[model samples]
Target: MANIKEHLLNTLEELATEDLKMFQWHLTNNVEDDKHIPKSRLEKADRHDTVDNMVQKYGQIGAVEITLDILKKMNNNQLAEELRTKVKNN
Candidate 1:
């Protein structure tokens, strides 16, 4: 079987430098462009509260995991670029 780490590294290497920049931007931007929607519970709690911690805690297959899975299956480089941009950089 192909190693996932090697595949990720290869994918990273193949992406254009600017695409990488955009990817990073999407990861950090989170709710940019008035797109920050809240969950049912959070909406009842606080409008300005960040959902990051909550998601990291309770979300099964957190955003990063979901994004990686989607990236692996969709095989759409553009979608992968968008999804990766929002992921927290290690």
Candidate 2:
């Protein structure tokens, strides 16, 4: 199984630029205040940086669940399900 970082990167790679922006926005805004990734930080992050930051802030499982939540908020249920399946299989 791929590591969590690789899984996150693979999932993020599926998004278009606009969708990625929306995903980041949701990520930044949807969490409890203490758990939020700063908009300033997310603004400059590429996929790798984004994944690293998420893992740093939330740990692997929390980061994956947060990503799933953001994806669902963006109406990307298919991607969320795909990511959940991948994580479960691993």
Candidate 3:
């Protein structure tokens, strides 16, 4: 059987550069989704506020785990591994 950790790491390595944008986009969307405000009202939200909201909703580790899961589900293994390493080393 393939090692899931290695597979995830390989996927991260392969797509890390390109998939970063995709991951960030998804992260932003996911964070926004948790907001109670209407989508139409979110236009005034600042980047820092949005990120703060995400951390508020998920905490640091939880937010990272959620984003990693999102990347994995989207078949963005390379980017996921890159994030995993960042989190691990930080």
Candidate 4:
């Protein structure tokens, strides 16, 4: 089974640049308080950097949950389901 970080990276790697930006936008605006990621941090972050920051702030499972939630909110249900399935299978 892949580690949570690898799963996250793989999931993010699937995104196009614009979609990735939208994903980051949701991460910045949708979450509150401790779950919030600073715009400055996300401003220049790539997929790996974003995953690193998420893991740092929320740990592994928390990051995955947040990713799943944001993906769903973005109406990217296909990716969200893929992530859920991967996590479940692992």
lDDT string, candidate 2, 1-90, tens digits: 798778889999999989988888877988999999999999989888889989999999999999999998889999899889898889
| Per-model tally of clashing residue pairs | 5, 0, 4, 0
Model 3: per-residue Cα lDDT at residue 6: 38
Model 4 regions lying over 4 Å from their true place: none
Query: lDDT of all predictions, in order shown?
Result: 0.41, 0.90, 0.54, 0.92
lDDT tens string, model 1, 1-90? 433333344444554655444333333444344432334433333211222433443352354453354345435557566446534342
lDDT of 3 at 4: 32
Q: Highest TM-score, which number?
A: 2
Model 4 residue 37 CA deviation (Å) reads 0.8
- Scanning candidate 3 in windows of ten residues, the lowest lDDT window is 35-44
Q: Where does candidate 3 stray beyond 4 Å?
A: 1-50
- The sequence of per-residue lDDT tens digits that candidate 4 reaches over residues 8-81 is 99999999999999999988888986689999999999999999989998899999999999998888899999
For model 4, the local distance difference test gives 0.92
Which pairs of residues collide in candidate 2?
none
Sort the predicted structures by lDDT, highest score first. 4, 2, 3, 1
Ranking by TM-score: 2, 4, 3, 1
